[model samples]
Target: MPVRSPSLVELNAFLAVARAGSFRQAAQELHVTQAAVSRAVLRLEQELGQAVLARSAGGVSLTPAGTQLRQLVEKPVAALQAAAVRMRKTPERLRLRLSVVTSLGALWLMPRLEAFHLLHPEVEIEFRQYHHDEDFTRDDIDLWIAIKRSAPQRWPRHIAAQYLIGREVVAVCTHERARTAQTAPLLLAQPLLYHSNFPDNWALWAQAQGAKLPLQRKGAGFDLVMNLIEAARSGMGVAIVQQCLAEADLASGRLVIPVPGSASTGRGYFLCRRRAQDAHPAAELFAQWLMQQAGAPPTV
Candidate 1:
């Protein structure tokens, strides 16, 4: 009997297909074709003389052998990619990658980021608008600004998070609607706009006011806060949106907070990072600048 040496190219192809569980997706990642991906996997499995995957109606699944190989490959593949990225970096300038929810990205961070850039001309800021579900730590994101429960134990040990702002839900509507609502249907009777993450927001606000919320009475639902605010601004409905998101509109007299109440949802915007010690120099500087901005007296 003769031993056969494994092919790294075929092994990589096999791993990609296994991880993605689809030949086409793996091919896309490798910049090859589905046929090529299949051929590579077949070659790898033939050389090993073992069935690495099981064919199924739904898709492909790794056999015990394939599972072991995938486990072995994932770490090295990730490490290689990380190494390649690190090798290319010359560190001439400080760069920070920030992951922020869309609304906060528009409402708060963007408006103030210019000042930070002006102060630290050498530091470059990179912003990626993200949704709520994505994990900032896993993506190698430098910093994450989100509304998260303030539970230290629930998060990973490598990540450090802090409460940045006290959450406030304000009843906001277009200025015209606010002026008209002072006499017509009560604030509670106004059409409700809902954000996916805060469906019970109106109810919570009502509860804070010692009244049963009528949130279930049918209304428009928006997946994004910006859309919801735009709907309110268009006089389509009234929304109980976050005060921070509504600040500019409120100040510009485009929107008005006719109701006077704040509900503590036990949630607030938090800054999360994977151990501040390893943070990018630009990220650290931005964090410090944000803290100073937060602590400074409200000029507006």
Candidate 2:
């Protein structure tokens, strides 16, 4: 026998009867006559070749087939109803989805998000975090903030990339460690913290100071900047991190820059978007605001 598809109306009628256990009650809930609800379910049974409901003097009860069908369609039907309601409510509101690095999202973006919200209460923001080398093309992301050695070259042809902010790498430690009599050599002897994504940060800083780091230096490694910064603040190790991420910790006296100066990594943060699609108005505004906050001039 051929598998017949039941209409959404029929499925809805069946579900109502199954939930209420009475065709009359289901009809009342659906704003239809009891006979109409019964006819819809009968038509559904004919298509499926199974008697789904067992009518009783008290009320209708589900047969075995009806129980299985109800279990499968219940949640999906509810989800569809919910989606319809949401569509009716905010069909025009702009939903801007962004992908950002974990550390940047936690330390920098989250703090400044309130300002964006206050400026555009109508816009909704969704955040997605991507770690090292994760593919962004399939993510359906509206915008991306990425740290790169230079402008990205491997992005899809439709993607537009713009330089956001250049980062300065600095070595930081807990306030207690900063208070100790520490020299560059002494600091190198201490356990150094490293980011898994940027493992050579300490070496890069050492190179900027015209010194070669020892091959056997002790250190702890973390996959995220926030974790590395926290580890440093907890006195676990000395952390080499971007100046932007440590600014708050430094200002609050939780962490201090043990090193005197920063190293230029020839790298920077970039804002990326798909060029073929019209930019979401909210995303454009947020991008401009981000540039303003980073003190970078808007690109033409």
Candidate 3:
């Protein structure tokens, strides 16, 4: 007889634990009891005939087998779940497909989505996150909340755009680093942190302010905004990033803006869609809700 594969539930539980690195945290994330999560992992281990995870006081670490399995299954599992959801939705349900760059999606949108879900329980929203760029050609997406330059004249004529918020770049570092307001001299004294996708951010901000920042750069660049933020919080260096993405930390006193005046780098966020596609009702509702949340005018 062929070997029986682990069930999806078991794989999901295992993946969740691997992600969280603790059964308790994974259980909380999955909205299940800790005992249930433990049982699922146990069942998976029994099926595999070996230990996949190493448990200890420091928390769980994946074994060699677990690491291999996680690499193979993570994307496939998420895709399977997404496909299943599409198949399971009823005709009566209103669904909206939306895309956005990863930084804005994680830092800004995800935290505020609960309110939208509360207000419009009947509308189902699907979020597709892109790491580097916005993809407007995907036929299934109803709308895209994208980060783009403020110049509407440059936008594709075939796309309809709504203004959201301008991107204000701020230089942030720990209190230990910046005893006073940020200046070009003070900023250049420390490492200049940047995001890989927007490598020109520091240059843009400097030019916007006419600060004459160095043409050649030094310091680290992170592909993910979260990593850059954490690096700033850890006092790795002064990081230039969008203000909206770092507001939570600034409010909590985890990070402080050293820049005397945040500079707009001639870019902003816009809600966009292809001109040819008919808008979904759910997309309309989401767009309205998002505009209100963003305090932006409804039209471009």
Q: What is the TM-score of candidate 1?
A: 0.63
Which pairs clash (backbone N, Cα, C closer than 3 Å) in model 3? none
Give me candidate 3's TM-score against the actual structure. Answer: 0.62
Quantify how close model 1 is to the true structure by its C-alpha RMSD in Å. 15.3
Q: Write the per-residue lDDT of candidate 3 for residues 1-300, one digit (tens) a residue.
A: 986988899998999798668897677657688999999999999988999999999899999999998888876776575444346557257788888877777787787888888866777888765534444666778888877844344667566676676567888889888874367776866888998877778877777667877766578999888999999999889898888788777877888887677776667788887655552557756776786678732111
Error of 2 at 251 (Å): 1.4
229-287: candidate 2 lDDT, tens digit per residue: 88998998889888887777887878888769788776767787765445256675567
Question: Which scores better on lDDT, 1 or 3?
Answer: 3
lDDT of each residue in 211-241, candidate 1, tens digit only: 6665346568898888999999999978878
The lowest-lDDT stretch of 10 consecutive residues in candidate 2 is 291-300
- Candidate 1: clashing residue pairs, number: 0
